[model samples]
Target: METGWRRVSARKSASRFRRSTSRSMEESTSSAWRVTHRLSSRDSRLRFLAADDSGSSSV
Candidate 1:
């Protein structure tokens, strides 16, 4: 019963996240790039490229 309840809660949150992302891929994509830029400033170009790839794939 405890495990079942945990699964249900996790599913709910996962669906909520999926809904938010899928509903506005453009918004998420922009936000993603923004963060990537901020991170890439302190990180590597490879990470930036990885982020861009993921963003495009999601779209």
Candidate 2:
């Protein structure tokens, strides 16, 4: 029946859409994690530099 064929096609389309959306979500999460890690590292380095400068000046 035509209705049966249409139902199968709809299911296939839904699955493909789900896969694409999942991939995009994964990529976005990875990028966000990388950005956050880089920012944290930069902040730590700045703190270290500030501390070093203060220590050197005291002498």
Residue-wise C-alpha lDDT for candidate 2, range 1-59, written one tens digit per residue:
99999999999999999999999999999999999999999999999999999999998
- 19-59: candidate 1 lDDT, tens digit per residue: 98887998878899999888878687777888999999999
| Candidate 1: regions farther than 4 A off | 26-59
Candidate 2 ranges beyond 4 A from true positions: 46-59
Q: Could you tell me which 10 consecutive residues in candidate 1 have the lowest summed lDDT?
A: 39-48
Q: Which ten residues in a row have the lowest lDDT in candidate 2?
A: 50-59
Q: What alpha-carbon RMSD in Å does predicted model 2 have with respect to the real structure?
A: 3.1
TM-score for model 1?
A: 0.41
* Model 2 steric clash total: 0
Q: Provide the lDDT at 20 for model 1.
A: 88
lDDT of 2 at 23: 100
